[model samples]
Structure formats: C-alpha cells, structure tokens
Target: MANLDAPATAIIGCGNINRGDDGAGPAVIARLAAEDLPSDVELLDAGTDGMAVMYRARGAQQLIVIDAREPEGKPGAIYEVPGDVLAAEPVHGVGLHAFRWDNALFVGRKIFGDDFPSDVQVYLIEAQTLDYATELSGPVVAAVEKVAAKIAARLVIAPEA
Candidate 1:
C-alpha cells in the first residue's frame, strides 16, 4: 500500500475534449475523478490550456501528466517517460491548439526554480485519431481506462484526509 502522507503529486491531464482520440487525457482524468484516489494527489483537466497546467503542477513532489501522442506505435500503446524528456522531445498539438508539454517545462522551471524534483513522469498514450468530435471512439475509451489505472497504480499515497 502507498503511504498517505507523502507530498502532493499533481496529475495534469491535457487534451481537448472536443477532439476524438486527442481527448484521451481529459477522458482518463474524468474517470480518475470517479475512482478513489490518494488525498495528496491533485487532479486537473487542462484541456489544451498548457500554461495553466504548468502552474497547477508547481510544487508537486511528483508530477504525472497524461496526454495523447502519435508516437507511431500501436493504437492504445502507452508510454511513461520522465519529465526531462520534454525538453528534448517537443510535441505539437494535434489540431488547432498551440499548447504542448514542451512549453510547460519553461513555465514550470520559471515558477519552481531550476532544481525541481527530477522524478516527474509523463504518460503519453498513442492516439489513433484526433478528429474534432465530442465523443471518443470505443478503442479510445478503453485506452483511457487502461492509462488511468496504470497511472493510479503509480501513486505513492492514499487519502490524506
């Protein structure tokens, strides 16, 4: 079991819910809200608002961000990568959005100072399509559930309350 009193872990799910597979992150976040999670974990639905996510994630001991990525892998494939990788591997928004995780690094570092925790992890799920639709396809839904559970398992604490 995870310790309940650990420092907060910020889970920022970034995506546009109006899009199909691109909405996977926010979809997983919605599902996470329904589940019982550790009290120290703060969940945010960024919805392509990247700068707000950076501030929301500030001061977290561990930050776990989830987003959709077309990594050219199998659909529904998941990746758990360290945060520093964001600086090296920048991402582009799927459609008309201009915000991406790479920009969040600059904002985070500017707000949190240079030597933040090196343990931040980002989980990117492979997206099949990112159409501007309000609903997610069946496969995307399954992927969101799978990714959310995987992220929850990585949580370090139970309810702090």
Candidate 2:
C-alpha cells in the first residue's frame, strides 16, 4: 500500500470507446475502479484524449498507462513495457488521433519541466478488432480484466518507491 503522504501512482487508460477493441483502456479503468486500492492511487479513463491524460497525470510520481495496440501475437496477449520506450519506439501511427503517449511526454516535459512523473509504466493489450462498436471484443475484455486485476493486486502489495 502507498503511504498517505507519498505521491500517487496514476493510471491512465487511453482508447476510443466507440471502436470495438479500442475500448480496452477504459475497460481496465472500469475494472480498477471497482477495486479497493490505496488512497494515493488515482485512476483516470483518458479515452482518446492525450492532453487530458497528460494534464490529469501531472503531479503523480509514478504513472501507469493502459492502452490497446495492433496484434503482435495472440489476440488477448498483454505486454508490460517501460514508458521511456515510447521515445525509442515510434508509435505516432498507432491510433486515429495524434501521437498519444509520446506527445504527452513531450508536452509534459515542455510544460511541466520536472514535476511530471518519471516512473512511468505502460501496459499494452493486443487488440483483436478495432471496428466501430460500444463494447470491447471478448479477447480484449479478458485482457483488460487480467491486466486490471494484476495491477490492482500489485498496487495493494507494492511499497511506494
């Protein structure tokens, strides 16, 4: 559990809800919202809004982002990656909007200077489908629940660094 005085661990779920499996991020947000997490752990459903994601996460010391991307393996596969990898890996073309996470980094750095979270983590889910729909695909929903449960459990036991 996090200390009451410690900076928060912010989790931003980024995705388009109308687009089938693209709703993965918000799905995780919904799952995590139902969890009993530390007071310092703040969750946000930053659906397709990179600016809101960055602005909402400004003061957090440790940030975790959940998002959906193209399939790299199985449909429901999940990958945990360091946030700094965004710079090395080009992800500008992954979404229907402008570069989300990557540009948020640039914007945060440019605007906030040094107060932005440095300990950033990203959870990527392999999306099976991304067509127009209100609900997530079955595989994506399973992935969201799995990742959300894992994150909630991890946060409950994880000591704030």
Predicted structure with the largest lDDT when compared to the true one: 2
* Candidate 2 C-alpha lDDT tens digits along 1-161: 22344347888899888988888999999999988888888888988888776776687788889989886657879999887777343344344366576678656656676677788888999998888889887888888989998898778765569
> Which residue pairs collide in model 1, if any?
39-159
lDDT of 1 by residue, 6-110 (tens): 347778888888877888888888989987887778888888887766666666677778898873747778887878878442444333256566577655565
Once superposed on the true structure, which residue ranges of model 2 sit more than 4 Å away at CA?
1-7, 88-99, 157-161
TM-score of every model?
0.80, 0.84
- Give the TM-score (vs. native) of candidate 2: 0.84
